[model samples]
Target: MKATQKGRSPRGILAFVVAMLLLSGSLRLGSIGIAVASSTTDVDPKLGNVEAVSECVTDAETHELMELLKARSEQISALEAEQEKRQIELANAEATILENLSRVEEAETRLSQTIQRVDGASSKDVNKLTSVYESMKPKDAALLFEQMSPDFAAGFLAQMSPSAAAGILSGLTSEKAYTVSVVLAGRNANAPKQ
Candidate 1:
C-alpha cells in the first residue's frame, strides 16, 4: 500500500489530464463525469467522477482530424506549386510568341523597303539605257543590236520612238529585222483573252 501510494497510478495520471483539459476549456465537467462513471468506479477526488472514455474519444478524434488537415494542406500546397509553374511557362511562351511576331514584322518592313529601292533603281537604269540608245547613230545602234540576241534587240527597240526604232531596224540584216519584229509582235502573246 505504501509502495502504491509512492508511485503515480493510471487513475492519478488520467485525473491530471482531465484537469488540464477542463482548464483548457476543451472538456466540460458534465462530459467528464459521464466518461469517468462508465470507465471506473474509483474516481480520483480531484477529477470528481469524470469519465476517461469520452475524453479519450475526443482526443483521438482531434488527433485524427489534425492529421487529415495536415495531409490536405500538403496536397493543396503541391497543387498551388504546380499551378504557379504552369503560369510561368505560359508567360514565357507568350513572350516567345511576341518576340517572334516582332521579328516577322521587322522582316516584312525591311523587305518592302528593299523592294521599293530595287524598283526605283531598275526604272532609273532602264531610262538611262533608253536615252543612250536613242542618242546613238542608227548604224552604231544597229551594230550593237546585231551583237545582241534577237529577243534582246527587240526589247530595246520596242521601248524606243517608232521613227527611231525604224531607223535602227533599216540598218539591221533582213533576217535580224524579221526576227526582232517577230519577237516584238509575240511579246504580248500571253495577254488575257477578252
Candidate 2:
C-alpha cells in the first residue's frame, strides 16, 4: 500500500501541472479575442473620419485653384482690352498722318500751277519787248543800249535776228559795242556741254 501511494502522488502532481497550463492558455485566448473586438470597433470610425478629412482637404484645394484661375483670367482680359485700345489709337494716328500727307500733296500741286502761270506771263512780256526793240531803228536801239548795263544790252541783242543785232552793234560807240560783245561771248561759258 505504501508503494501504490507513492506512485499515485507523482501522477497527481503531473495532472495538477497540466490543468494549470490549459487554464492559462484559455485565458490568453479570451484576452486576444477581446483585443480584436475592441480594435475593430474603434478603427472603423477612425478610418471613416480619415476619409472625410481627406475629402475636405481635396475640396479646399480645388476651390483655391478655381479662385486663382479666375484671377488670372480677369488679368488676361484686361491686357487684351488695353491692347485693343492701343490698336484703335494707332489706327487713328495713321489716318491723321495720311490725311496730312494728302493735304501737303494738294498744296504742292496748287503751288506748281501758280508758278507755271506766272512764268508763262513773264515769258510773253519778254518776247513782246524783244519784238519792239527789233522794230526800232538801229540808231534808236543803240542809244537805249548805251544807257543799259553791258550784260543787259547783251541779253537783248542775243534775242534779235542776226541782221537786226548787227545793225544795232554798228550804231553803238566802239567802246560800248566792245563791252557788250564781250558779255554776249562769255554768257554761255559756264553752261554744261552735255
Candidate 3:
C-alpha cells in the first residue's frame, strides 16, 4: 500500500506543476498548488503586458548615435549661415548697381551740356571768320585759303557761297583744289542718321 500511495502522491503532483509554472512563466504556484494557470487557447488581458527579454544597446552604439546627431545639427547650422551671407552679398550688389546707374546718368547730363557749349563757341568762331573773308577781296581771300591746310581750307569753303568758294578754288593749285574738294565731300560720311 505504501508503494502505491507514493506513485499517486499529491505533493509530487504539486511539485511538478510548480516547476512547469516557473519555466513557462504563464502560471503561478500558490500554497494550495497551481492557483492560476494559462493555456495557449485562453485570452487574458494581462498577457498584453508580458515582454520578451532583449539585450540593451552597448555604450559604443549609444555614443555613435549621439555623434551622428551632433554632426547633422552642425551641418544644418553651417548651411543656414552660408545662406544668410549670400543674401547680404546680393543686397550689397544691388545697392552698388543702383548707385552706379545714378552716377552714369549724372555724367551723361554733364557731357551733353559741355557739348552744347562747345558747339555754340565753334559756330560763333566760324561766323566771325566767314565775315572777315567776305569783307576781303576775292584775290586776297584766295591767297589766304591757299596757304591753309587742305582740311582747314575745306571747312571755310563749305561755309561760303558757291560762287565765292569757286573763285577761291580756281586760285589754288589743281592738286590743292582737288584735295580740298575730296575732304569736303567725305566730311559727313560718319554722321549718324536721325
Candidate 4:
C-alpha cells in the first residue's frame, strides 16, 4: 500500500506538468520546438521525472519568448522611424506652401502700387512729364520714357511746345523712337488721350 502511494506522486507530478502546458498554451514563442525536443530527447532514466522535464521545457520556452519579444521590439522601432519620416515630409510641404503664399502677397502689393500710379496721373500731369523729358539728358529721358505707357508718352509729346518736343525727339536714336511708336500703335492705340 505504501509503495502504491509513492508511485502515485509521479502521476500527480504528470498532472501538474500537463496543467502548466495547458495554462501556457496562450504564451508566445517556441512552443512547438520545446514540445518536439522534449518528446525526442532520451531521459537519463535514473533522473527521469515529470517535474524535471517540465522545468527544462519551461526554460526553453522562456528563451524563445525573449527572442520573440526582441524581434517585435525591432519591428516596432522601424515602424516608428517610418512614421517620423512622413511627419517631417508633411511639415516641409506645409512650409513650402507658406513661402509661396508670402511671395504671392508681395507680388499683389507691387501690382497694387502700379495701379495707384496709373490712377493718379492726369492730362495735366502727362503734359508736365513731356517738359521734364525735354529738359533731361537723352539717355535719362529714354529710360524714363521706356517705363511709361507708350500711348501716354505720345499724347504728352503732342501737347508739349514744339521746340521742347523737337529737342527730346533729336535726343532719341531712331531705333528707340521706333520701338515706342510700335508700342503706342499696338495694344495702347485707343488708350486715354490723357
Candidate 5:
C-alpha cells in the first residue's frame, strides 16, 4: 500500500503542471491578437495622412501654374498697347508730310506766275527800244551803232525796213559794218533747217 500511494502522488503533480502551462499559452495568444488588431487600425490613419499630403502638393502646383498664366496675360496686354501707340504716331507723321507737300506745290505755282509776268514786260520794253532806234537818221544811228557791241547793233538793223537798214550800213565804218553783218549772218547758224 505505501509503494502504490507514492506512485499516484508523482503522477497527479505532473498532470497539474501541464494544465497550468496550457492556460498561460492561451492568454499569450489572445494578447498577441489584440495587439495586431490595434496596429492595423493605426496604419489606416497613417495612410490617410499620406493622401492629405499628396492633395496639398497638387494644390501648390495648381497655384503656381495660375500665377504664370496671369503674368503672361499681362505681358501680352502691354505689347498690344505699345503697338497701338506706334500706329498712332505713324499716322500723324504721314499727315504732316502730306501737308508739307501741299504747301510746296502752292509756292511753286506762285513762282511760275511771277516768271511769266516778268518775261512779258521785258519783251514789251525791247520792242519799244527797237522802234525808237529805227526812227533816227541814218548818220546818227550808224554813229550810235559804232560804239555798241556787234551783236547789239545787228539786233536793231534786223528790226528796221530794208531801205533804212541799207542807209545805216552805208554810213558806218567799213570795219564796224563788216562785224555787224557777220554777227547777223551767224545768229541762225545753230537753228534746225527742218
Candidate 6:
C-alpha cells in the first residue's frame, strides 16, 4: 500500500486536469457534481460557483463588443479622411485643367491676331509698291530702280502694257536697264509670287 501511494502520487494532478477538462467540455455541472460526489467526498473550497460563470461570460462578450465597436469607429474615421483628401485632389486637378485650357485659348487668340496683322501689312505693302512703280515714267522709274531690287522692276514690267513699257524703256538709259536685267536674272522677279 505504501509503494502504491508513492508510485501513484500524481493522481491528484491528473484528477484536477480531468475536472477542468470536464467542466470546459459538454459535461454539465449536475453531471460533474454527481461524478465528483461519487469519486471524492472532499469538495474544494476554491472552485467557482454558477454566478461566476455567468458574470465571466457576460464580461467577455461585453469586451468583445467594445473592441468591435472601437475598430469600426477607427475604420470609419480613416475612410472619411481618405475620402476628404480625394475630393480635394479632384477639385485641384479640375481647377488646374481648366486653368491650362483657358491659357491655351488665350494664346491661340493672340497667335491668330498676330498672324492677321502680319498678313494685312504684307498685302498693303505689296499694293503700295506696285502702285508707285506703275505711276512713275520708265526713265524716272529707272532712276528709282537702284532704290528697289531689279526683280521688283521685272515683275512690275511684266504686268504693264508693251506700249507703256516701250515708253519707259526708251526713257531709261541702256546702262540702267542692263543693271536691272542682271539683278533680275539673279533674283526671282515674282518674289512673294502669291
Error of 1 at 54 (Å): 15
* lDDT score, candidate 6: 0.72
Best-matching candidate per TM-score: 3
Clashing pairs in 3: none
Q: Write the per-residue lDDT of candidate 3 for residues 60-177, one digit (tens) a residue.
A: 9888998899999999999999999999999999999999999999999999999999999999999889878867777888889889999999988998888888888888889989
Q: State the C-alpha lDDT per candidate.
A: 0.87, 0.88, 0.82, 0.72, 0.83, 0.72
Instruction: Indicate the TM-score of model 1.
Output: 0.56
The TM-score-based order of candidates, best leading, equals 3, 1, 2, 5, 6, 4
User: RMSDs, each prediction?
Assistant: 14.9, 14.7, 12.6, 14.8, 17.5, 14.0
lDDT of 1 by residue, 1-194 (tens): 56368897778888999999878775577688878576654556896874444333457788999899999999999999999999999999999999999999999999999999999998788878977998999999999998899988888888899988998999999999999999999999999879
lDDT of 2 by residue, 37-118 (tens): 5654533465564221222235778899988999999999999999999999999999999999999999999999999998
Clashing pairs in 5: none
Best by lDDT: 2
Model 4 C-alpha lDDT per residue in residues 146-166, reported as the tens digit of each score? 566657666656666767655
Question: Per-residue lDDT of 1-194 in model 5, one digit per residue for the tens?
Answer: 56457776666777878989999999999999988555544334655632212222357778999889999999999999999999999999999999999999999999889888888887777777777777889898889889999998898888778888888898899999999999989999999999
Once model 5 is optimally superposed onto the true structure by TM-score, how far is the C-alpha of residue 101 displaced, in angstroms?
Answer: 3.1
lDDT value, candidate 3, whole model:
0.82
Clashes of each: 5, 0, 0, 0, 0, 1
| Model 6 stretches astray by more than 4 angstroms | 1-76, 142-194
Off by over 4 Å in 1: 1-84
Candidate 4 TM-score over all chains jointly:
0.32
- Report the lDDT of model 1 for residue 16: 91
Q: Residue 164 lDDT in model 1?
A: 87
